[model samples]
Target: MAAIIGHILPLALGVALSSVPIVVMVLILLSPRGRWSSLTYLIGAVIGLLGLTTLFSAIATLLPPAPPEAKSPLIGTIEMLIGVGLLVLAAIRWRRGRRHEHNPAAGTPKWMSKVSSLGPIPSLGLGFILMLRPKNLLFTLAAGVAIGATGATFAEAVVGIAVFVVLGISTIAAPIIFAVADPARMRRPLEGTREWIERNSSTVTTVVLLVLGTVVVGSGLAHY
Candidate 1:
């Protein structure tokens, strides 16, 4: 269980470090309908992450089983593919970041302009959609694969998936949780955080993806 958790930690962090979700979360927290909307959004995101990761884990479990020390070619192949995909995404992020840095007009998504007006349902739907986006999906898949490949008992799988979901949603949940506790005090800091993340998100995600991609690739190679 510990070994499985270790393998999936980077993948979980990859999902947690998603900047857009965090940015949207901050925006939702600053809205008039902040409380309910933010809570629902967080809930929606949790469901999406939990469902997708569990689905992929189940899929991985369908693969042929191997002995404790034996190589799992299927799992290795899947991990390698996921690793390469992440590296490619890192390159794309790096390029996009350079462009955004030079273009002063580069800003938040158009939909975000009206985020303040969104109600709980829309916010909830939006949160789910965000997790379905390519980068987040890939990270979730990687974590799922890691969990499923372990062939742990049902209880261990539950615990593993739960830990992954918690870690994956930590960043998005933290701001909302804090704001709920003390909206007045957290407002200014949340605004500052939103702006900083807007400016530096690409760089942060790119670096994280690079490091995680390498680690995943190394793990994949070891399976052979």
Candidate 2:
């Protein structure tokens, strides 16, 4: 478990560092019936990420092993492909952001206008959707592949994967944890924080994707 943890922790942490979901979580916290809505969103995020990671890891187990010589390289190939995909996504997002910057109104998600109208169930669904965006899904898949590439034992797989899930949810978790520490004074700050993050989410995500994608590709290449 320790060995597996040593290997995959970076990827897990990388996946967890997304700003958009954290912003969305804070948004939920500021919504109508916010107390439960945010909590439900957090719950939904945890479930979505953990469940998807588990499924991917399980699927990895079912895949036939590559020939010994090709093993590391095969994993590397997959990682590189995922990295390239991420880079492409980053470019696409960057272009969209540029366009949005020029036409600010088009950049707004209609959902934001209706956040105050959300109930617990919708909040939960929104949380799940926010956490499961394509970039996140790919990152989770990359993490799962890294885990499987280790050929981890049962104990190693369980513990290592759990750690990955925890780290992956850290961004959203941190703010909520802090708010829980002082809900009274935190509300206004949380809302302000959310707005700031939302305003910068695209650029942040694009940078994150570019950096992580480069790192993932390098890691994959190093397998050779």
The whole-model lDDT of each prediction reads: 0.89, 0.77
Give the range of the ten consecutive residues with the poorest summed lDDT in model 2: 63-72
Q: 1-224 in candidate 2: lDDT tens per residue?
A: 56457656766766776776776677667765777777787888888888888888877776555455544677778889988888998899899889888998785577676776678888788778876788888888887776665677777778777898898888788777777677878898887887787688789878988988887888779767
User: Can you tell me which runs of candidate 2 are displaced by over 4 Å?
Assistant: 1-3, 64-71
Candidate 1 minimal-lDDT segment of 10 residues:
61-70
The candidate maximizing lDDT is 1
Model 2: pairs clashing at backbone N, Cα or C within 3 Å: none
Query: What TM-score would each prediction reach against the true structure?
Result: 0.97, 0.89
lDDT score for candidate 2 against the true structure: 0.77
Runs in model 1 lying further than 4 Å from the true structure? none
